[model samples]
Target: MEKIFTLAELVEEYGTEVQKESFENNGNLNRRSFDSIIKRVEQDWESVKEEGRGSKRKIKCSGKLEDKAMKKDGRVRSGRQQVEHRIPMDVIVATHLEYDMTQQASMSLGKWAVEFGLITELEYDLLRSRHSSKLRQKHIDKAIQSGTLEEDQTKLLDEFTQHCLEIYGQLVKTLEHMEKCGIILFYENWMAYGKDGKVSINPEIMKKILKARRELMKKHEVVEFNLTAHRNAKKVKNFNREWKETLAEVKDENGNKLGIKYYWKEYAVILKASSKAVQRYLETYCVDSLEVYVNDKDLFINENVADYELKRKVNIMKKAEKRHKQKLQEYKEQKISFATAEDEEWIRFFYTQQELEDIVAGYDLGVKRLHLQNLYMERMGQLFELYNIKGYNNKKHLEGVS
Candidate 1:
């Protein structure tokens, strides 16, 4: 029997005053990153221990990742000292996984994962078991009970009883096609601890990831961050910063000319606003009417003014129309070219478009087929970016990846 060392045991055996400090700045074992990674590892180890299966990996020290322990006398103490180490503190242990026992452990975890709602059963079967099986009656009943799926669409999918049927079914073939075509299709899930705790990546999960994934995870094995600071950064990028400028004449109390007021405001807000916004703004300002200036002249003028003073909106409309067409053309060109290229790529990769469509059609076990399609699209999009970037943003997937 192979003996597995608890992290703390390893630390006590190998750590000295200088080992942790000496490896602190070393590229492979960054101290700060390791500090956080170890905290997560300990927590995961504890969770497994608490659930009674932690025997796969014993815990050297157990504590919540976020808080320090308070003694019975109410004094706080450091939880992680010397003997309680997390990986990247030691390179050899961090990257190691037991090959013989990992698969069974992973299947147990995968089943537990489904029971806890981390991933759908179909996803677990495809990713973990890869064996022929029938669609769980639970999923089918739930989909119907949810009522989002149309009866007709649900019926169409229901007819494909062999999709996951026990008799060497359609699912295996579909999955084979998906894998061969480099079409990334998998459910997203993580067994996360409390609000501030870490996501547990079981040895089983790691084995699969290591088997096929890039070197990033292995290279940075000890620095895994469950929550990234950059996850939502792009949402606010350039937000409300795009501005537009227009000129409007301001009249004096006596209706004399007041030179143009150069107005500037957010372009997106203005473009997206409905006509009702104009009335709302007028009410807020306690003004009876406000003239809109488009391009160089006033777009709205009362009959009290000269007919010639009423600037026709034709010029403004022309500009809007031109902009609309340009945007549409760009979208069309990019979309058509990308779709064609992707289709070709699928064929070249040995998975036909018809097979993909059939696979999707088989999975449409609900009325909300669009929602189901979106999940696949999102997964595929991630795969497209990842593989394409490895090829240095190859010309094929650039305009079409989105």
Candidate 2:
């Protein structure tokens, strides 16, 4: 059986004169200081106790890391302390399972974990602040049901959840956009190996796709939704503003001024609006107009195709026209799902022309899964730059050792 020491005996055995300086004027230990020391010792008891005569008695830390902690002035350095080593503080804390260091670091680690197959998509959702809020409210509701919370406390929590709802709704919109554009699915499919014992479907193709996805995520991580307030359209219309310069009349060679161009104001407003917002507006207001334009087949086909000078060019156009009709028939027959205008626009940003063509033709889930695994490897390389964790960043660092 192991020996157990009471709080008094442990303090008497390990507390130094310097630690005693933190005691109260009445010669009693300060609870805060004592707790701090206890926590530090719990994290690195071996290093703390090894300097004294009672060093032979070993005490284990609750954390997974068993390495001796760095010491300064005979006190164990806590996780919050700045690491003096080559690795970053965040990296060290994450490796030791001390996630409370920083939310940004923890979120980055969560993404890295998903990329490396260390965690599932469901597990990663818990790391998101939006999901965390929902989960908190869930427990709050449960507590209310169980009559565990005071009436005042319950009221406050209910009000808090209501305030969080709007922010949660915004987060859901952005996350749904991510899911629609295949970012979420990409990570989900990454955590698997193929039949050939290789992860990627095609490394060369996936490298480009992964880079595009990374750029997209980085751009949107701190996105401005402009949810609360609208742009000052009233101010833009004022004559005193610089936007008036855009409305300046066009000049002719003879110095005669043309009428003020209305297109400029339209262009300015459209340019200021987000693509999704603009698309939504157009879809709501211009659906009939778009349908009318699309149905005008005469606008698409040239009446004088036979008048072309080059036979090769004419043959190519004919083939294109034939393929168009085939695609229309395929849509009519419902053999393949047709991409919406929004989806097409989104897809153009993330895929190459050839890849988009193949996707429109048909995509195999197995092929996509393989590609995602390749993308995973590419993403892990980027994660290494974010956190300089030794072994995970470089495979060669742990090539031979188990």
Candidate 3:
């Protein structure tokens, strides 16, 4: 198994070279540096003692004996393995502090960490405590100078206080950027847990988180296509024309092709005509009438009158009705003419299916553009927080007076 390096061991062995090469090599601290540090830590592991807990021996397991016992048995046995202290507590704590510092700086400056890699939970806690202590001590010494305490340690207190304040300010800015980007705080916490830590986020959970964040930022707009209505109208006109053409070829028996006259027959013709005429009439006029009736009975009845009273009324009112129908037909033709012109205008104004599809594609492109823009803004905010322009300016003013 590969040995893990404690923070102190990593720093003592590799930190200087990693930091020096990082800027020149585009901020990548190579694996070779880490490997060398790990080698050194493994060589010294037995001698290294745990911090604060005096003279305690490192834990170890007798793996050789366990392997021999397992080989002797025909059946394999399953049980918990013995725990060994592979990495020292001091190293773990130091590594975590270094990682936290690098990460905190990266978040504030919007720059990748060059020297330190990942931190552990113990290190993070230690760094936080050290920061808090320096801040509190600065305040305590200032109070003491105002006769709060007779003796006070004020040496380099102002510089340490400023450094702590700078770090805190950077941390706040980094947190804000993370929030804006929808980055969960749990990632940092998880990293702090170190390699031996078992807690982890599943890939499925991460995918869902990404999806939700994307949806929150997405903006949608509807686009419509007008082809359906136009297509239906065209279908209706084609079907009507086809029905009329089919009805025009009527014939009758007596070997004569019957015209539309054969359609007025009240009963099946006991041929006063040839079989050919009768058959032709039945096939053409009869079939045509039946088909018309099936498609639209109202049209068939309007063009073919049967009642005596209605026929007589039709003859008597024929001239008046023809004039009235002519006027109505003329009015309907004019309405149809106007409607056709309006339809052309509407076709020009509205989107076609092709155009609507293009618009939807443009919306998808906008989503990517918007996400990138937001990310850029978030990164800019992080950089501004790192520099501490306000504090730097205040310090310059105080120095000019001195």
Clashes of each: 5, 0, 14
Task: Kindly list the per-residue Cα lDDT of model 3 for residues 1-402, writing each as its tens digit.
Answer: 223334444454446765545524543334565444433343334233223211121222221211111011112111101111111111221222322333242221112211221122222222232324343343334334433222322212222222323323333333332232222131221111112332233344335433543443232111111111121345434533442343233222233222221111011101122333222222222343445545654564443433312332233234333433553444334321225887757754786644544354432322223232343223222222322122234334323323
Top lDDT: which candidate number? Answer: 2
Per-residue lDDT over 149-212 for candidate 2, one digit per residue giving the tens place of the 0 to 100 score: 4332433232222322232232233233323322222121221122223232234433543454
What is model 1's C-alpha RMSD? 32.9
lDDT of 1: 0.29
TM-score winner, 1 or 3: 1
What TM-score would each prediction reach against the true structure?
0.18, 0.17, 0.13
Q: Which of candidates 2 and 3 is the stronger one according to lDDT?
A: 2
lDDT agreement with native, every candidate: 0.29, 0.33, 0.30
lDDT of 2 at 36: 55
lDDT score, candidate 3: 0.30
Best TM-score goes to which candidate? 1
lDDT for 298 in candidate 1 is 28
Which regions of candidate 2 deviate over 4 angstroms? 1-19, 22-32, 46-232, 235-402
TM-score of model 2 (CA atoms): 0.17
In candidate 2, which residue pairs get closer than 3 Å at backbone N, Cα or C atoms, i.e. clash? none
